[model samples]
Target: MTLASSSKPSANRKPTSYESLMAGVAAGAIEGAITYPTEFVKTRAQFSADAGGKRGVMSILTDTIKTRGISGLYSGSGAMIAGNGLKAGVRFLTYDSIKELLRDSNGKMTPGRTVLAGLAAGVVEATIAVTPSETIKTKLIQDASSLQPQYTNMVNGTIGICRTEGVMGIYRGLWPTIMKQGANSAVRFTSYAWIQGLMINFTQPPSGKLSSTMTFGAGAMAGLITVYTTMPLDNIKTRMQSTGASLKYRNSLDCLTKIIREEGVQRLWGGTTPRLARLMMSGGIVFAVYERLIGVMTSL
Candidate 1:
């Protein structure tokens, strides 16, 4: 529900909490799977200097089909489906839950601190549940020529990593993932909450229910902000993760400087095409599903 709607909760038009949460998770999972092709291509372009870091999205897509074929485009689809879905689910839950707590404590939500609440939610999801999957996701997108010992199965390769390294091994790239996502979350959750506030203001409710369109719009706006703000870190984070944990620049800061010196400043934005598309589509789907799921659940 939009913040405006929440301010004046009523018995008749209440939105269902369960429906909202489920909708987002399901949408994020499905969209994450379908968009895996784009994400894989994006990952390859960002990480593989051999792939010609400057290749256009079209070229990358075609190259993927010609060389690895369709299945290759979704090499890490399984992990993404699970990871992204969980990320979306937890992020939403945390965001709303925190907002509720804050409101209860302070009387009402102030838009000025919307980003703070969002940062709280993002940190929780990224650190606890999403980090491992994200690290694996990066490895899965590397070029076959560049595939490392741990990334052989791409996204599914983490199964072996877990067997060998235990739970900790899966998080080899956890720091960078945390760094990237923490910053990304600041942008995403803030924008989402702020936009939701705007929507509520524009469409003040007779009760507490927001139209489905408002939820989608808020999600998309929040997504756009997050993707653009942190896409550079995201690119570097993916590259570092794909590299063998033993090899590579040692840590996130090192990975940052190396990419800048070697690939030039523009390299940070590599694979932005798919990343943008991924966020826009997935963001809208996630929010819509999240809100609707809760709505339906409440209805039942």
Candidate 2:
């Protein structure tokens, strides 16, 4: 949820915790399912070259399809759907709850408060839900040195990880994930708020109803800004999560340092195109669906 601009008429209806939670689950699952192939492509791209020279996005996609078939692109989608559903549900629920608590006597949420709420939401999701999902998803997508698969599926992979690495193994990149998600939420909410304000002023829609087109466009822009701004952290998070041990780097800082020193700074932006592709639609779908769903639920 976003802070209503002065020019845009506020519905003044807050969704109940259940409504917000369900809407977030629906929106996040839809977004994840629709955009998962791109996510798979991106995860594969982020790792180091596999004895062959570095492959581009298309090569990775094509190789996955050829070797593993079309299903390869959806390797970790089950885990992703569950993970994203939980993450989004908790994030919106926490964000809205925090916003409600922080509202002024006028019953209005300020942009700053919204940002802080988003930060808290991101941290909560990262710590509780995202890290495990990301770890599993990355391992599933990463090409193994062996010809045979290490883990048969998400369930097996998760079990194997826990059995071998324990709980901490499943949460390998917790810090980077938290940092990435925190920055991601902060940038996304703040930029979307700023963009929404500008759009409301610019279009001046009658009755203050924002056009779906404008909302989607704004979401896309916000997604771009958030992804680009946090690409480095995301890259580090991905590497740390995908790597089983400290063969290459010991920690997040070491990962960052090694990536810059060994692979050059530009390596930090690996898989950006696929990530952008996934998130552009994901961002738009999430906000648009969420806003409409919440509105409908409120009216009911």
Candidate 3:
């Protein structure tokens, strides 16, 4: 984790953040629709200290039924749609573009440098593209519990904040989201460097450079690593975004320490099962798509 800062100067190239953003938006839309219900449950599980003992694995499902009904699960889905779509697209494109700038004069990319490049790109990507969306989504998801009582869903949440907290109200819990996403991006990008090499060895590309499939395999492996490493930060982030967020965990570090004390270390990985599934699937899909985009770029 003691790697060099991405702030090291590099050549300027026009960033296609918008294109990548559109792609991610498409992907994010699909992803959010498929995953939000589960995300809803995951958020609940992470923050529901009051519910006690999870109410069991089926608790969220049952509770969604008991309380807000079916659509309850999709309460904050709009923010997820906007945030995840842009975040996924922008993060990938920025990371790739940064790595290319830092490639060796030999045209070969070093894994270490690649990692640093990804980290740099991640910091920017998370800040510019994902933070606000994250802010909104977190607020909406937590609104389900009625704890904050201010934010309930997208429309009301936006209006509520505009009324009380002003334009700034939309940016709740931004600091922790930054920490979590920045770390998540660093791990994912760094892992991809090593994982891609391993895949190249295992897959053995046809004569002309590493095949797209090999690169994708590497991405899949890197994705698996990211989910496990970042799950705890995610758990805390979810809780911070929960309905009754006044529980007082403070920042990500503070919330983390409290979770360990109250729920044990294992509680940090609250919804890893579905999360891993989503991570791998989304990572693989996005990486493969990104590879294809690069192929088109190279050809042109």
Best by TM-score: 2
| Runs off by more than 4 Å, candidate 3 | 1-21, 50-53, 65-70, 145-153, 207-218, 243-247, 296-300
Off by over 4 Å in 2: 49-52, 105-110, 143-146
- Candidate 2, 111: how far from true, in Å? 3.9
Q: Candidate 1 vs candidate 3: which has greater TM-score?
A: 1
Task: Compose the digit string of candidate 2's lDDT tens values, residues 238-296.
Answer: 98887564576689999899788877888888889999987788778888888778878
Arranged by TM-score, best first: 2, 1, 3
- Rank the models by lDDT, top first: 2, 1, 3
Q: Give a tens-digit lDDT track for model 1, residues 14-52.
A: 344454456557866876886777787777667555235
What shift in Å separates residue 102 of candidate 2 from its native position after superposition? Answer: 3.0
Q: Estimate, for each residue in 55-145, the C-alpha lDDT of model 3 and write its tens digit.
A: 4447777878787789887887887777777777777667656766886886556667766766676677667766666667666666666
Greater-lDDT candidate between 2 and 3 = 2
Backbone collisions counted per model: 11, 0, 2
The lDDT values for all models are 0.69, 0.80, 0.65
* TM-score for candidate 1, residues paired by index: 0.84
Native-structure RMSD, model 1: 3.3
Instruction: Give the Cα-based TM-score of candidate 3 against the true structure.
Output: 0.78
TM-score of each: 0.84, 0.93, 0.78
